[model samples]
Target: MRMKKTTTAAIGAAALLSGLLTLAGAPAAHAADGCNNDNGRTVRTAFGGKGQGFELRVNGSGNSTCAWGRIVGGAPGMHVWVDRSSDGGRTWEPQLGWAEISSGGSIWTEAWRDSNGRLMRACGDSGYNTAITCTTWY
Candidate 1:
């Protein structure tokens, strides 16, 4: 039940891009009708760390039209980021975060794994929409 994801991976201002880091995101299209989505369900997530897991960043509006995206389509503050816990998903990095709060929000993100291996990722404002959302897989 993986949802189609859309995203933008712009790191720093274009003036600082070094062509090293990847700032790519998911596609733009959204589900035709998340109608099947349960009621009162917010925060949509998928995962693969150790135990069964997935976390919802936001609540389900039950519209199926709502997803991890800019509140108004292509906003400039919200974004997505991800980190890993090679040490058995115990400790993560000090940084390696994502969001759009700095710029007032950028866009929400669809979570998923990059390969066939088990993966888990996510994207969303911490809560107040002050930082960019993020997603990562491994």
Candidate 2:
């Protein structure tokens, strides 16, 4: 009976490990710039428009070495982008370029390297004449 229980426990552990490995092998979301959004976390969020239906997210890499923008509830022709600043969000240094949501209601923009005390933020336009919204600097 003891041997039987040990065999069962070993089988269960092997199954669990196999499942974990499968998940770990899953592909990550990659942008044209080759940055992986799967390694990032949303550092800030902002809402806009009626009932706050539109959403903007500022995602930062796990190591704080990269940042990007993502828009949810977006529409075709809508736009999203990431901004970077070297002076603590006082003024924009350069933008990472905009991503037009050509289809669906969600999209991710190109990533920008966040280095040298740079701050990053997410911004978007609904393309419906509504005012643009931006998340706070991270």
Highest-TM-score candidate: 2
Give Cα distance to truth, residue 8, candidate 2, Å.
82
Residue-by-residue lDDT tens digits, candidate 1, 1-138? 123222232334443564333433432223333322233233444432222122333223322222222222323333344343335445643222344434432343332222222222353443443544433432
In terms of lDDT, model 1 sits at 0.34
Best by lDDT: 2
For all candidates in order, the CA lDDT equals 0.34, 0.69
TM-score of each: 0.26, 0.63
lDDT of 2 by residue, 3-90 (tens): 9999999999999999999999763433334444666667788875632332323344444476778877767777777777789888
Extract clashing residue pairs from model 2: none
Positional deviation of 97 in candidate 1, in angstroms? Answer: 6.9
